[model samples]
Target: MARPTIYSDDIANTICEQIAEGRSLRSICLDEAMPAKSTVFAWLADSGRDDFRTKYVHAREAQADVLVDEMTDIADDGSNDWMEQKNS
Candidate 1:
């Protein structure tokens, strides 16, 4: 099936949701269910899509926060610090 080009709240929300979930727009756009990256960019560029643009920006910020949290968790975890190489 062809990807959707028409702007809709559902599609906009889906894009933002994926972004918030730490998925890249490029990757999301690759999905058959989503529009092309250029189309998404166009949506962002459109002045009339202020709501979607806001949501998209917030989603990106949220994704960054999630990445930082994951990094912090990895740094705090000491379970792997005790691992030593075994002699063959």
Candidate 2:
């Protein structure tokens, strides 16, 4: 029997939008509204849509930059302990 589809363009778009907004894909996928992480990975790697793949990659890169910025902030902040760095 065929498996139920846990993915759709609307869901994909929402994931991409979350990434664009500096959210982690893992965290986004963990939400009950989003699909499984494996499903999202399969979609990105095999969906055969250059536009969507490119957009997702770009958003991922942006999110990486945001993470680095946050790390830098935590390091520069003498007020917070090493483990006390911001959650996001």
Candidate 3:
């Protein structure tokens, strides 16, 4: 027997949107009662949604870059690490 079709593009798009909104994959899967995480990831990775994946990856990278810049600024100011002199 042939396997069932578990996902539609519309549904996949909705799930991807939720993920892009900062929702956790586990949470979306649980809420949607999806069969498996791999199923959702596969749907996202499909060729039809390549644009979505590219946009999502770029957004995440931008967020990471902002965080790194903030950390670097703090470290340069010596506020990220400080050592106190101890008397023996």
Candidate 4:
């Protein structure tokens, strides 16, 4: 199916939700049901889309937090950082 061009509150919310869940806009746009990346960027550039832009910004901030938490978890994990040694 062709991606959506005309923006809607539902679509905007869906995009924001996924973004907050640590998904990239490029990946989200790859979905056949979502809008193209250019379309999303156009929405951001459009002055009339202040609300959507605000939501998108907040979602990105949340995504950053999620990424930081994941990084911390990975850094804290040393399960694979060492290898077992055997006596000769």
Candidate 5:
């Protein structure tokens, strides 16, 4: 007999939460207890359940927001002459 898959609702939700917090799937898969990258991709590929798929997409968008925020902070640091030169 083959071993049953060990995925669970709690694990899925936790992954979604991490995604919402801006953690990439690659990083999530790096954790000791997290699912494998293939498993997570399988979840994203399954059309029957929109829950995980939707969460994953939204989480990617959240990561973009994080990137923009970081860029804004760096641009506003006021310690650089790059902006002055650009505006000149």
Candidate 6:
């Protein structure tokens, strides 16, 4: 019996990209004619690239939140100063 061929990084990346784009794993596998769903998952898990992607996404979201808070503070600063003057 012939052994099944292992998928390459390019193929795995395509699968991951498709998933990130909202394609279901079953749909991708069926469209791509992939041998098994587990194979795609294994590729993603083994590559260690997903971990970095997750970390990057989280960091970017945190940065955005911080920027929004800073902008809010700047916008409120004048109002706060006016209120203090009125109170005094």
**TM-score list, all predictions:** 0.83, 0.71, 0.44, 0.91, 0.70, 0.41
Tens-digit lDDT track of model 2 for 6-80: 556777777788897789888887777677788777777785766668878888887888888989998998895
**So what's the TM-score on candidate 2?**
0.71
lDDT of 5 by residue, 1-88 (tens): 3322466777888887787776787888778688788887777787866877787777778878887888899888878744435555
* TM-score, candidate number 3: 0.44
What is the lDDT for 68 in model 2?
A: 88
lDDT against the true structure, per candidate, is: 0.92, 0.76, 0.62, 0.96, 0.76, 0.58
What are the RMSD figures for all models against the true structure? 3.0, 7.8, 6.2, 2.0, 5.2, 11.4
Candidate 6 residue-wise lDDT, 1-88, digit = tens: 3222386655655655655554556787775445467665565466566763564345446556666777888887876564335555
Off by over 4 Å in 3: 1-5, 32-35, 45-52, 55-88
Clashing pairs in 1: none
Per-residue lDDT tens digits for candidate 3, residues 1-88, read: 3322376656656665665555666776665444367776675578886775776576456556666776778778965577899999
Which pairs in model 6 have colliding backbones?
A: none
Least accurate 10 contiguous residues by lDDT in model 5: 1-10
Task: Report the alpha-carbon TM-score of model 1 versus the true structure.
Answer: 0.83
**Any runs in candidate 2 off by more than 4 Å, and if so which?**
1-7, 81-88
- Clashing residue pairs in all predictions, respectively, total 0, 0, 0, 0, 0, 0
Between candidates 2 and 5, the one scoring higher on TM-score is 2
- Model 4 CA deviation exceeding 4 Å by range: 83-88
Error of 2 at 76 (Å): 1.3
Q: What ordering of candidates by lDDT runs from best to worst?
A: 4, 1, 2, 5, 3, 6
Candidate 5 deviates by what RMSD?
Answer: 5.2
Which candidate, 1 or 2, has the higher lDDT? 1
